[model samples]
Target: MPLSEHEQRMLDQIEQALYAEDPKFANTVRQTNPAVHYKRSIVQASVGFVVGISLLMGGMILQQVIVGVIGFIVMLACLLWGLNAWRRVAVGGEAAAQSQTKGAEPKQRRRQQRPGMMNRFEERWRRRQEGDDR
Candidate 1:
């Protein structure tokens, strides 16, 4: 359900109060965009992957099985991390761009209508905990 104008105003007031109470935290949260962070992570992972490949080849030529295996593992990990970051960047960036073009009315409605995966998981966890307490 969309918030009524009165409720929206109240929520805005509460947000303003929160920012006033902790300007630093509010600034940090507002300033950081997850898509940008994900892109940076992808770059770092690419560099790590290249290093891992060099280490793996060097270790193999040097006849050190342990070193080679470790290098291979590191390379695999970096590749996986890079792929995950790329996925996040693509999804988040696209969603952000789409939202800007379409405007906030539909976006807010969609957000309000659907509970996120984390919210559902948290709800289940809370129920389990309550059951355990009893």
Candidate 2:
């Protein structure tokens, strides 16, 4: 939904305040979000690696060794890029998930919640059986 006139004015005022107070921060926020860009770079590099490998294989099949070598270089670059991004994401993902689940961990540790989690699977199964019976 579009903002009402009052909300629009408030938003405009906020934007003005942000720019006036810290134009650099406003511009930085407007540019790119690093996490989003990192994720995208990882995806792009992965796809590029696969495509490059395929091209390399195709060139080899045509007996174009030089072209295949060039393709290998491009694929290696992609692999390095993807690997770096994946490492960053893996480390960050672990920390992020741990933070989100911090409180839940105490409950899990106290109750041996792995079994309870499994009971949830059983509950789902029971519901499915009931659904099937109906």
Candidate 3:
């Protein structure tokens, strides 16, 4: 549902007050991009994965089983972390594209119409289990 004119004005006033109270903080919040954060996470994970590979190789060269196991664990953790960040970025990008295409539609309305991430994942899992390639 669209906001009433009075509600919109009130929201605008509140936002203005927030900016007035702390321009720097408000600007920082406005400039922050979640996608950038996710991308940074991915880069960090990639670096950690490389470190893990080096550790694994070093362990093998030094004949240390414990070091090798630790390296494998680190590799697995970084891989999972990177994949999670990638999925978040993909989902967020898709939502942004959809919102742009939708023009001025209320975000609440769009959210209600769209399936949640978990629902989409569950649906995909079901399809895979059923051998539906599509």
Candidate 3 has its poorest 10 consecutive residues by lDDT at 96-105
lDDT score at residue 100, model 2, on the 0-100 scale: 63
- Score candidate 1 by lDDT: 0.88
Candidate-wise lDDT, in order: 0.88, 0.84, 0.91
Any runs in candidate 3 off by more than 4 Å, and if so which?
1-14, 93-134
What is the Å distance of residue 118 in model 3 from its true position?
26
After the best TM-score superposition of candidate 3, give how far the Cα of residue 71 lies from its true spot, in angstroms. 0.8
What's the count of clashing pairs in each model shown? 0, 0, 0
**Per-residue CA lDDT of candidate 2, range 30-125, in tens?**
886566767998999989998889879988899999879888998999999998887767657556766767767788687773567778788888
Residue 133 displacement (Å), model 3: 28
Considering lDDT, which of the candidate structures 1 and 3 is the better prediction for this target? 3
Per-candidate TM equals: 0.57, 0.48, 0.60
Per-residue accuracy of model 1 over 45-126 as CA lDDT, tens digit each: 9998988898899898999988888889889999999999998787677666676677968888988899989998888899
> Better model by lDDT, 1 or 2?
1
| Per-candidate RMSD, Å | 15.2, 12.6, 10.8
lDDT of 3 by residue, 43-114 (tens): 999999998998899899999998988998999999999999998898797677677778756776877899
Write the candidate numbers in order of decreasing TM-score: 3, 1, 2
